[model samples]
Target: MLTLYRPGTGWLHRMPAGPKLLLILSVVLVVSLLPAHWSTAAIAALVAIVGYTVSGLGPGLRGIRELGHQMFSLRWIMVITLVSQLIFMGPEPAVANTARVTAAIVLAALLSLTTRVTALLDAIERGLRPLERLGLDAARCALLLTVTISTIPVLGRRAAEVRDAQRARGARNNPQTFVIPFLIVALKHADELGDALTARGVR
Candidate 1:
């Protein structure tokens, strides 16, 4: 699996996963509370940059690149969201919305850069242990998260392949050109993964 995790010994990487998750959540909450303005957006961007630096530059840039790939992969969804905001709230609000979403995404990318997927899965299981009383299977939940994390790069690559193929075939700026192929590839991946898990007695 092409994971966002980068092996490193920086302070950010050394920090416990639970605390890192909490810090990211806190930052998101704080940023969300700020009024939608250039100053607040700039501060959010700075925080994201600090997050990237603390995580280590090379890995952080990789994560950012992965995020950019995902953004382009799901351009149809983004376009729809952008158009809806423009129609309902005008262009200024749409711009602010896009900025806020982008800031949150960059912050998340930075967090994923420093934290390993396995560590994240372990943290999820630990956090959900208390919910076992409610019939939740913490291990299963963790495995699900692990699978989701592992599939991100795969989906991004598949989308890129589809886009390139469509462009070669003279398809232009159409949502179906990308979305249909991406969905098909995603479904195939899920089926293969499910079969592999079953073979391994994942139940």
Candidate 2:
């Protein structure tokens, strides 16, 4: 989901976006591909501390909470993943997998919180420039990424609106009761987005 860059003069704010992005990718890869250990949790804690320090106390706490909420939204998937891993690979692998994933997510959130959206987009485009030799349009790829990130929060808000309406009508707050209406709202939102983009002459 897209989040605004909080104006700040912190070290992270002044850091070059390209290097920050590269560091984020490197950290996520290390945490994800390496065997997990208690050290992994330490890494996560360290990243979190840096994120908070860079963001400064007030905005930093808010940013971390926002990132935490996104991870919280995936609770069911984490639960299922842990349970399946526990059944097949035992507790150790389960814990490792979950911890690594959580750390990767936290690191990504830190990157987003610290970097400006335009800077992030420029960095992504620069990274993808090599693919232009393969006939890929780097600008288009960056635009798509921008739209995708921005649309996530829009769709999430639509879902929340649908849920609240259903609740007000006394519908049970279960997936069975919510999914259909939520889907309908999402489709409608997508249609509106498409029309707006078309009107703006975006391909």
Quote each prediction's TM-score.
0.70, 0.65
CA-lDDT, candidates in order: 0.69, 0.67
Whole-model lDDT, model 2: 0.67
lDDT of 2 at 50: 56
lDDT per residue for candidate 1 within 17-40, as digits (tens), equals 888877877777777677766576
- Model 2 Cα lDDT, one tens digit per residue, 116-173: 7778879889989999999999987986775654555445446667767987999886
Q: Give stretches of model 2 more than 4 Å off.
A: 1-4, 37-42, 55-74, 144-202
